[model samples]
Target: MRFALFSDIHGNLTALRAVAAAIDRAGPLEAVVVAGDLVQGGPRPRETWEYLIEHGWTLLRGNEDEALGADRIIHGEYPPRFRAAAVAQITWTRKMLGGEVLQRLTGLRESFRVATPAGDLLVVHSSPRGTNDRRGGQHNSAREVVDGYAGTGAAVIAFGHFHSNFVRATAFGLLVNVASVGLPLDGQPIANFTLATATSDGWIIEQRQVPYDRGDELAAAARNEMPPWPASEATS
Candidate 1:
């Protein structure tokens, strides 16, 4: 069986289209899963959410997605250093999405486990510990990376949140970050996704990058009057 996994779309329809085309080109995928961050932070948030809903992709909730249904932060719920612009974006996103979209976003699951020919695949927006686990993505070193999934039961842990693509192996199991579909922070202007094929012997994982005209996305963001910080997840 083959599975196509992508995450952190962040509401860029152009990038999503390019990734979809790439998936078609890579054809015969058993399933397509959007790990999280389907909406918020760019042009056409409604369109992106609708497209994902229409296509019936398996979805998970990201931090931004959770914020869509939440009230503005009054307490110290998030990082103390979190930017005001991000808070503003979340507020604007919640207003733009309205009640219906917020309901949809709220319905997304926090994680998913799939049985594959190779073994079990655990998919989550961040680490299995929870959605707010920063260590899952922002590991300081290789040992920290290995320690992040110390007790996960699955043979493979697939997650997205850091917007960087990497596959790592530890004594516990294998961890894969499928990266971002809309906003990649790896200094690359390309969209990314991962394909995992299970065989009798083991599992084969391939990361696919599709180059699309980011200028189009930028233009859309400008036309929508979205904040400039929406362009880059890492720097923003």
Candidate 2:
């Protein structure tokens, strides 16, 4: 069976649509899992949430989702510059999302697990420990990354939060960072995802980068006068 995994939509409906089209073109997929951060950066927060809900995609709550639901980011501290921008954008997103959408966002799960022939696949926004885990978003050291998998009990852990993509074999299991769909920070303005195909030997995973019109999203950001840092400079 083949499963398509993506995350960090961040309200870029264009990227979301492009990635979905690419997944459909790839043919039959057993399931589609969205690891989260569905809104609060790009232009269309409400639209992005509606589209995902309409499709009934499996969901995971990202930090942004939690912040949006709470109407404030809860981190103890963040770099001053980035924290200010994050607060502005998330506050805007919460107001833009209003009632029903915010409720739905609050209801999203923090993690999920699926049993595959190759192994138990655990999906989370950042790591198995949960969405609020700050260390899950960093690869500061190999030891730290490996330690994040403690008690997961899954051979494959698929996640997206750092906006970077990588697949690595660790002492715990195979860790797959599916990356971001809307705001990739890998110096590449492309939509990213991961396809996991269960084989007789094991689970074969493929990371995919689908090209979309970055200009459109950028223009929308410009027109809306969104924060110009972070996502815009991510590809630089």
Question: Best-fitting candidate, measured by TM-score?
Answer: 2
Tell how far residue 74 is off in model 1, in angstroms.
9.0
Count clashing residue pairs in model 2.
0
- The sequence of per-residue lDDT tens digits that candidate 2 reaches over residues 1-236 is 88999999988888899899999898998899999889878877888888998888898898878888777777533577777777887877777789888998989888878888888888999887767564554455776776677667798888988788888787778888898988887646689989999877999999998987777776776776666445555421
Superposition error at 179 for model 1 (Å): 0.9
Task: Kindly report the root-mean-square deviation of model 2 from the true structure over all alpha carbons.
Answer: 2.2
- For residues 145-190, write the lDDT of model 1, one tens digit per residue: 6656677678788899888888887777778899998888864568
Which 10 successive residues of model 2 have the least lDDT summed?
A: 227-236
Candidate 2 lDDT at 193 equals 89
Q: Give each model a TM-score.
A: 0.89, 0.91
RMSD of each predicted structure = 2.7, 2.2
TM-score of predicted structure 2: 0.91
Look at candidate 2 and give me any clashing residue pairs.
Answer: none
Runs in model 1 with CA error above 4 Å? 73-82, 141-147, 230-236
